[model samples]
Target: METQMGTVEDNEGNTYQTVTIGAQTWLAENLRATKFQDGSAVNTGFIPKDDDANLLTFGRLYDWHDVIDERNICPKGWRVATDNDWKLLERAIGISELEVNKEGWRGKNDIAITLKAAQPDTIFKKFNQADVNKFHFFATPAGVKLGNWYITQDMYTEFWTGSSATEKDAYARTLAYSWWNSHKGQIRRAKLQKSNMFSVRCVKI
Candidate 1:
């Protein structure tokens, strides 16, 4: 697992640090661009109140439509990570190939904690388990945007995969603490509604 670090600027002129884990290179930060590469507005989804600071920390949330649009939400030479891309990342971090493809909470050996940013008030902190951020992925608890409200800002986070699971839903990965009993600090593969909004992380093509 050779690792490399670098920087890239998106079409919005916002620059993000990038990291290479295993064979894939990824944006170390969540994407905050509000427009597509073609200069079209990405649906704002739902911006929470006092989000001026949150925008910098957590990045903007986008529905699946914005993710799959041909105009491109990620920077040049990069794309939203596909489901398989995520599996590669999981394997790089020590999850077995068998567990990476599972549909629910997966991974052993505190693998989910390895992806979360080390914040003082995060769920990992509550359990006295430090979020190592071993791969420098910097996943924040940006939460999710539902129909007219935002929920769980600092307790959980999810990312949309470019792959679709059904006409109405798409594949996603989730990180949470005690979301369901006994499922603390693990990653989940989910089929989520396309209309709901989640954080985005780009991978180099």
Candidate 2:
């Protein structure tokens, strides 16, 4: 597959690099918009520890309510990445057709490594400079906001898919370091609470 690159600006004038992986074009970084396209504020977002600096690197975490809002958090011509969008990315990165749609952790041949950003930190047990982050998706362990507490700042990262599994839960994708000592990484598909806060990535519509 050919990889194409470009840039986009959101409502708040925040610019993001975009990468074309397979047939879809996705934001290379997590979204950091505070307002909708029509100039409406998204009041549900929260920054970790009230640090405004984190907005540029980690982006703001938002609940599912803000994700599916009609005002649209993403820039014009783009939308929050959906469950099928994630599956397409998985298949493009080497996951088999059979495993791409399965729930729980489903990836093969270091797929997680290919999707994560190559950070020089101890959060990952193993690091491969050559094969990691081949697509420039730049997945980071931005952690998440649960209720009033922020946890897992550098351990793992989860992105909310625009697909809903139920009224109270929605689908999401997770990338994390394996518990055992190894270079291999893991990706998971799970349904989480709609109130839980997670990062968002936009896909070109």
Candidate 3:
């Protein structure tokens, strides 16, 4: 695909790279905004205790509540990708839309291969670089913050979806570097508690 690259600046003046994927335009980088578009701070969002340097690389991890906040976490004219929005993006990239709306572990299209970034050999032995920017998704392994100190940095990354699976649980997508498959990574949708902090990737409205 002929991907068009661009840039977007958040209300706070933090700029992010943007990429056009099929019919949609997305933030090529994970969101690192500390405030909502309305200028309200996301006080509940977790910023790793002492890891300021990694924040730029991984972006801030936010709780589901922070995502659902009416103030809006995304920049103006953009919003967090909804579950249906994710489905549309996947189908645009050729993944079947059959399981797109399913609650947990949906799809069998090797979605991870096309979305994740190429890792260094030190991180994974059989890393595949073929699809790193094939579609310009450029997903990174930013990991998650689940109450304990940041765990699995460079090993796993998850993005919060705007859809809520239940009153207390929400939908999200995850990408992981696994040793089981000879260090290959995978991506899928799953439900998570409202309190779990994960990365956010926004889509243009």
* Candidate 3, 1-205: lDDT as tens digits: 6788899999999899999988899998889888998898996556554478876777789998888788899999999999888888877776665766665554453556677665444333544566555777778778788877678777778889999989988889877665544324345778888788898999998
Scanning candidate 1 in windows of ten residues, the lowest lDDT window is 119-128
lDDT of the candidates, in the order given: 0.83, 0.85, 0.77
Candidate 2 residue lDDT tens string, 1-205: 5688899998778999999999999999988888988998997778765699877778889999999898899999999999999988998888888888888888766678888886443554445667678898888778899999998777678899999999999999987753542433658999999999999999999
TM-score of each: 0.90, 0.92, 0.88
Q: Give the lowest summed-lDDT range of ten residues in model 2.
A: 177-186
Model 1 lDDT per residue over 62-174, tens place: 89999999989999999999999999999888989888889999988667777777634343345434546767888888888887788888777889999999999999999
Clashing pairs in 1: none
Q: Of the candidates numbered 2 and 3, which has the greater lDDT value? A: 2
Name the top lDDT candidate. Answer: 2
Ranking by TM-score: 2, 1, 3
lDDT ranking from best candidate downward: 2, 1, 3
Q: Which stretches of candidate 3 lie over 4 Å from their true place?
A: 103-109, 119-128, 181-185
**In angstroms, how far off is 18's CA in candidate 3?**
0.5
Query: Model 2: runs farther than 4 Å from truth?
Result: 119-127, 178-184
